[model samples]
Target: LGRWINPDPGGTIDGLNLFRMVSNNPLTLRDRSGLRGSGYIYVPFLSRDTVDIAIALYTQKYAVNKKPDIVVFSSRNEQLDFYEELKKRRSDFAAAMGKSLFEKYNTSDLSRKSLLNAGVKETEIKSTIMSIGNYLAINSMTLMNQQDDEIFSEISIGDKLKIIGHGSAGSAEISSGGLKSVTLSMHELAERLDFSGLPDQALQITLLPCQSGDELLEPVFIEGKSPFMRTRPSAAESLFYEMQARGYRRVTTAGYRGFGQIRGFLESTGSHHTQRKPNSITASDDIVRRRDAKEIFC
Candidate 1:
C-alpha cells in the first residue's frame, strides 16, 4: 500500500497534510520525502513484522528501476515514549537519591562528603544514580509492542526477518526456541560494529530500543561518499550492533527527530535555500527537494 504527495506551490511539503491525505490506508503508513522526486511517498505496512518485509521488497523494487533504493526505520513513537519515561524516571530517581543521601549523610544536598559518608563512591555516585534512567530506557525499548509476538511468529525463515528491541541482558537467557539473539551496551555495540566489517545486506533484522533524546547520546552520521555510515556511537547504536551480532540480516535504522530538528538538518544541508527561479518550480518539486535532503542526511 502506498500514496504520493505532490509538491505545494512553495516547494515545501506539510507533513501533517500528507498524513491527513493518507489516513484512509488501513496499514500504518510512514512517509519518506525524497523518493520519487520530492513531495513524499508513503510506505504502508499492515503490521510491524511487515516493515522490513516491505522495505526489502521496495529496496529490490527500486533497485530494479535503477533508483537509489533506501529504507529508513524511524523510531518516532518509540523515542518519544523513551523521552517521556526518562524524564519521569530521572525525577523519581533524583528524589529517591536525595532521600537516601539525606538519611545516610544527614543532609539533603549532594556532595562528595555526603556521598562518601553514605557509602557511595564519589566517582560512581552520579552514574549510579543515573543508571536508573538507562535501565528504564533500555527496558522501554525492549518491551514488545502490541501484537509483536503474533507478528514475529508469522515471519518465515526465507524472508529472514529479525526483531530488534531492548531488554535486560538476562533476557537472552530465556529460550528463544530457534531464534538467534545477542545483547550489548551502546559502547560495546560501537566497538563491535566497527570491528565486524559486516555488509549491509547481511543486516536482515534490526531491533532498536528507544533512543536517548539527549543530543549527546545520539550517534553521529557522517554524510560523505558513503552516506549511511556511522562515524560515532549514539545511545541507540548499540542496539544495532546487538542485532548484527545475533545474526539477522538486511537491517536499516534511522534516528528520530521532531519537526524542529528535521528543519534544522534541512537548513544545515541548504535544503531551505530557494531555487534560482522559485516561480518556475512547482510546490511539489520544492517539497521533493526537502524530502530528498532528509533522505541524504538519513
Candidate 2:
C-alpha cells in the first residue's frame, strides 16, 4: 500500500511483482492507485434498454484485469422526469445570484477558514468549494417549493430484482430515474443491500444518470415549515448526508454534472435529445465525455 515499487527486493525486473504479490487476485484486492482496496459495482436497471449501451461502454472502460461486478435489476413503472423543473430552478438561482457571483462560487475558491471550519480536508478545500455555492443557491430556492412527502416517491419498491457483488464503491447507471429514481432511492439501496460481506471500511456511491449532480431539498418539517434549509445536490451527496445523519461515518458519495457518459462511445440510442449545457460544448464524443465527466462529491 505504501510506495508501489517492486515488492521483491531481489527478483528479475520484469515490472510486475505486485501482481505476483497478490497471487493475481485483483478482484477482491487491488494494489493500484485512486480507489485502492475498493471494488466497484455497476448496477443497471433492465427496463431502460438504452442503458445497456451505457453499461457496455462503461464495462469496456473500467473492466480491465479487475473487472467491475454487474447487477441487473428492473422497475415496473416509468420514473418521473424532473430534469426541466430542476434546470429551471438552477437557472433562476443563477440569475438571482448574477453571473459574476455565480461564476465566483461555481468555479472559484471559497473562504479557506470557513471550509476548514466546516471540516473539509485541507487538500480538498479548493475542489470541494467549487459547487458548494451552487448548492447553497439551489437550496435557498427549493425552500419556497416545499410540500408534504416531497423528498421521496410514494411508489412501492419494484419487483424482479437481482443484486450481486460486494463492491466498496458502487456506480448505478440510472437512465429513467431522475434524482429519486423509481427503481430505488439512495437510502433504500444502502439500507437494503447486505454490505456486511465487505470489509469494515468506508464506501463510495456514484449515480451515472444525467443531472444526477443537481440539488434537491430535503424533506424534514419543523412547526409546519422546514427548520434547516437542507438540500442534497446529488445522489452521492444524499448518500453521504444520509450516512452521516444516520451515524455511518465511513461513507462518501459522488455524481456527475450535466450529461454523463463513458468516454469515446455514444451510449444513447437513436432517440434524439439535447440539453442547454451538455456538460461540454465540444462536438467530439471523447472530449465531451472528458469535459462532462466532472464529479461533484459530498
Number of the top-ranking candidate, with lDDT as the measure: 2
lDDT of 1 by residue, 1-298 (tens): 1333443221222222323332333245453542232111111112333333333333222322223222222234543453465466557655665655434433346643344345554634544433332333323332222222222323221223322332221122111112344334444543433343333331223222222111222244575754343333433344454555556334433321111111221112244322111223344443423222221011
- Worst-scoring 10-residue span by lDDT in model 1: 257-266
Provide TM-scores for the models: 0.21, 0.39
lDDT of 1 at 201: 35
Going through the candidates in order, what is the number of backbone clashes in each?
Answer: 20, 0
Best by TM-score: 2
**lDDT scores for all predictions?**
0.32, 0.38
For model 2, the local distance difference test gives 0.38
Candidate 1 CA-lDDT value: 0.32
Candidate 2 — worst ten consecutive residues by lDDT sum?
152-161
